[model samples]
Target chain A: MKIDTEKLLMIPGPTMVPAEVLNAMALPIIGHRTGEFGELLVDTTEKMKKVFQTKNDTFIITGSGTAAMDMAILNVIDKGDKVLNIVNGNFGDRFAKITLAYKGESIKLENEWGDMAEPEAVKEILDKHDDIKAVTIVHNETSTGARNPIKDIGEIVKDYDALYIVDTVSSLGGDYVDVDKFNIDICVTGSQKCLAAPPGLSAITVSEKAWEVIEKTEKKSLYLDLEEYKKKYNEKKQTPYTPAVSLIYALNVALDLVLEEGLENRFKRHEKLAKATTAGLEAMGIELFAKERARSVTVTSAYLPKGVKDKEFRGLLSKKYNVVIAGGQAHLTGKIFRIGHMGTAKEIHILATLGAIEMALKELGVKVENGVEVAEEILMG
Target chain B: MKIDTEKLLMIPGPTMVPAEVLNAMALPIIGHRTGEFGELLVDTTEKMKKVFQTKNDTFIITGSGTAAMDMAILNVIDKGDKVLNIVNGNFGDRFAKITLAYKGESIKLENEWGDMAEPEAVKEILDKHDDIKAVTIVHNETSTGARNPIKDIGEIVKDYDALYIVDTVSSLGGDYVDVDKFNIDICVTGSQKCLAAPPGLSAITVSEKAWEVIEKTEKKSLYLDLEEYKKKYNEKKQTPYTPAVSLIYALNVALDLVLEEGLENRFKRHEKLAKATTAGLEAMGIELFAKERARSVTVTSAYLPKGVKDKEFRGLLSKKYNVVIAGGQAHLTGKIFRIGHMGTAKEIHILATLGAIEMALKELGVKVENGVEVAEEILMG
Candidate 1:
């Protein structure tokens, strides 16, 4: 009954969970008390700060990345408060929707699907909204292959006393974002993505300023009560809610793996792999949707060739190549598809994914050049 | 680096996750959009219905039992909505606090710790408040070891137009809770307690009547939004947001194990275990904290001797015999300890826990009979 994962999971989240990490999760569930539980929490939190590259308090929620987004927005942005949401792709829109649901006056600054949220537009919107209390944006958009200029955007929100809430869902361990240096009041990451754990928990951090906002704000939330947790976190290394204990165990292992690899090395590897992935796709005459702001790693969104269907290519990849890739969302459906190379990925994985694409293209009668050749040319380091 | 857990998890939740269920969780992460994902959702939902004993629409959330309680309240009860919350233990107070946070006018029906919410008290309260929209109660109070009579409480709320919401956190699989026959509108349960899965996601069912109230209510929520999930569940068997995929896999396996044991036999076994546990404890001259209402098989609170401290006894039990038990909360702290025998329990575990308790008492120099002989007599039956 013990099933070993045969396929290396390369999906965006729910990424490859190492055997050691899985076994760590299978540790007998202990009471959320005991010195053992406290020691685990303290160690996990301190290690989390190492990855987040911030001294600010890190609180892990027994939920998903979206839940973290909800926590960040619901707590920081008070109802009827002016806020600016920069939407570039799916995740950005989700943040905007979340901000709107919190009764925040959401002023949207949007861009084309492939484009990044422009710095000029954000600055302009901020200049106009004198009452704006917070401005939210995603560091990495999982839908489109784009990494926004979060550091630049974080700087923009600095002077205005507005809280900078960053959704670094797919970018956390792949690249570094020092929340303290960047003046980010709120930063969030998921366990399943670059952290390379199973999908269950979302790791979050809030600044002193952000905590102040949360304290005064009215929340209809009982689950993501940040202050409640912060209170408990201050006293005992415990969450206000019953946390996903096993997932926390898995996350600790994943964090250890990331640290062992070293952050700079991991980021550089992602950069190299991303370039190779883009090179491989272009070799097949397929243009990626997000050409201008193409992210270094984690995910890639590429255009489909004429008469080539995305669903067919994905199916063929799954059935024949034993690979899985994401198709385009609404309005871009059948036009583009996304491939991910997050935690536990390397040069070899991108090469295989492109190799599958090559086979799929040939079977679908699309004229294509060899992919691995181009991939090697870009990734050979 | 791989740590194998042979130590049985005898706690109320994160119960002994069988190896097969662990294997199921370790299955390769699938694309949430692919047919593979759809198949998992559809299959899980059907099995869930069978387990819940309800034909109502049920959805899973990546949260603890507390989150389920919050979602249940937030969805149906709005600002100024009158709610009657039965508070007898920690979890019951959780319901009250959550209701109050939502700006819901809740009547707190105070029941003694280690006592169930009285039916006559509920009837009297209901007679006074025609504005009451919902009546909330916990099925099993792990904090006090009391199982509320949902059958009688449901009948109390049945005559009124108000919906009945129940927290079956520790008793869903261990005991029979007929969601349909009991006239329960909303029921929430956690995976770890009796379901024998790790703690991460919580499952809840909403009846058609509850849906009507939720539909009419205008509330602002994002991550815990039940309405958003309802729209997606019917079409895609997908959550509006990404889910804790692997935990769902674990639940799938855990459900198989529970259904295999069958409800009737499972409940009978739990009842027998409860009887034996009480008889054995009494034979050793220890008094039960919840004798007013029979202790639930899932969890039960027991008082220590007047001279011996609960924490000191707990220390002896853990250090000597490796047995873990729940301690008292708030006012009850150091006065009582709780033992769980919910999931994956056999005749031996109960005796082992009792044997440990006996040894701890004797070591603490407390007056006590032979723990092993009394426990053995009850267990042999």
Candidate 2:
């Protein structure tokens, strides 16, 4: 059946973009090589650096976050090179897969799906494998709604020879990400997540150490080659190939709104949203999937109610209340649900989503508490 | 100096997008995993196949046309595999580079920049190397405005075991490309260009024959992996990763416009626009770059008149007349200029661009005939 209503996206990514950002993309398409596009590219990239809190060389790629993640691993890992992958969720596991796909030897420090990667485990792996050329981690795992201890792991990996690569696809704009202080050699993020922009464009920051590794590695991908991007950006403030011009226009405005909101304020807002969301779920007798201390500020994952079917509940919520949330991915499918409160999501969205969930649960003959009231209390407090 | 007016895009790929298509992107973002997105994806892909004139398995990649090109090569050619690359322009040369980057041995049949590849030359190369796994060529070269003899080349490649891979990045919607009739094993095109959608999204059609080769080939790239894309499409009508959702929305609308126009009528329109543009330039005492029979129907390239500087002339056209066109790429830089008249570009756009060029030339004190009147005569006739 068709849901004939204005649907609100509460997915982990491709989040709810603001009207201003969405309208910015409706502006006329411009030539990628023109001076106008160059200015837009430069301005957007500079602001992205401020949000990333790094002075490294930044580039915008015309692909999904997976492309940026692929670029991060492929640029540094050569054939037979050992890469240490800290796997806590799907995205972190993807790093391992990318490395393996490129003929690199991946040594995964595996953690439970909802658990965060321990810094001690990473340190032990690095200490054991002296030949490891790169270490990859996900700062915020969208799949399981878990946030890893990036700074703690960074401090441990800094003394090693391996370059530190982090995927901040869901965290850069919603959480505190100090790329330099965290010693992340390569940090990647998507435009649609916390930036509140349209999907399809991803940005990456490369440190000097990462460049050194990239330069020495034999290039395997022509489209994702970092050297070409660096050369093009240096010569002219433009991408090596034709960029997704309209998406960049949307992202430029998204970055403006993000900077205007102030990073600290935005991070605090995300924390509050996460707190309220979890509080409401807990008050409804739902169990949080992620560990308490390592919960993601962007997305919250929780167990489905005992008698509630995954599809029926979400379907009811979407059709009846016009609130769309994400189902569990991969192994977690049918067992849990995730609510994304990043980007343009506000307190009102959290309350509406909780209210919808409460009604949907009661309709299914499952007992639920006043989730809306509990969420409203936290939002007001 | 800034152009203080609404600028028109006349570049080769990122052509002018219709307001309807652009506004379609302004719709709110949706969850990629939802049934709504599934319907959107399935409907868009079916329409895209009609535009591609193929019933082959197609997948939309959330990257630039280059990404599709890379996928075309990387999926079929394993390490040290021999591939015949017919190079006539920048993009053809790029295919060779991608093959070489992936450790494939490239046998290049190089042609002049403004010339199309002769099918006999391709037959000669395939005859010499029976080990050639695939034959790669650009259907329409964007840099030099040359359209290749793809059907002729496809006939020869089909005789051999080599898979036929074509890049229709700049020609798919505007040109006559019957993928099934032409026996194209893997055909790739971008969402922009003749599709008149915003940039960023690219689509590829894979024949059963191409899939057989791809399935056996050792996959090197996780992001550009066609096998994964095929599996994902088979399981669900969704991309393997988060697609540029808004761009897909724009492309859905763009495809509706394309199919509504009918492919035959669209091709005729592009042909007429190209003819008028060329007539105007020739009337102004300019020289067309590509050969008479190989001229592109989407974009027309011509030599810059003597004593008229490339930068200053184009700058005047852009700033004074608010018309944006592309200059020559690579070695042809400063020697030629290109006018794109594909998708959403009609007779009026062609006339306005030519008139702007004439005025910009007159302002530069260059002697010229009334090019606009000449173009009008051709267009009206």
Best by TM-score: 2
Query: Over the stretch A1-381, how does candidate 2's per-residue lDDT look in tens digits?
Result: 122338877878888888988888788888889888888888889999999999999999999999999999888888899999999888999999999999999998999988888888888888887999999999999999999999999999999999999999999899999999999999999998999998899999999999988999998998999999999999998898889988888888899999999999999999999999999999998899999988999999999989789999999999887989999988999999999999978998998888888899999999888877888888998
* Model 2 lDDT tens row, B279-333: 8999998899999889999989999988889999999999889999999988999
Clash list (residue pairs), candidate 2: none
Model 2's DockQ score: 0.66
At residue A279, candidate 1 shows an lDDT of 82
TM-score of chain A of each: 0.96, 0.98
What's the C-alpha lDDT at position B374 in model 2? 87
Give lDDT: candidate 2, residue A376: 85
Candidate 2 lDDT (Cα, whole model)? 0.91
Cα lDDT tens digits, model 1, B98-200, are 9988889989999888988789999999999888999999999888888889999898899999999999989998987989989989999998888888788
Q: Which stretches of candidate 2 lie over 4 Å from their true place?
A: A1-5, B1-5
Question: Where does model 2 sit among the CAPRI classes?
Answer: medium
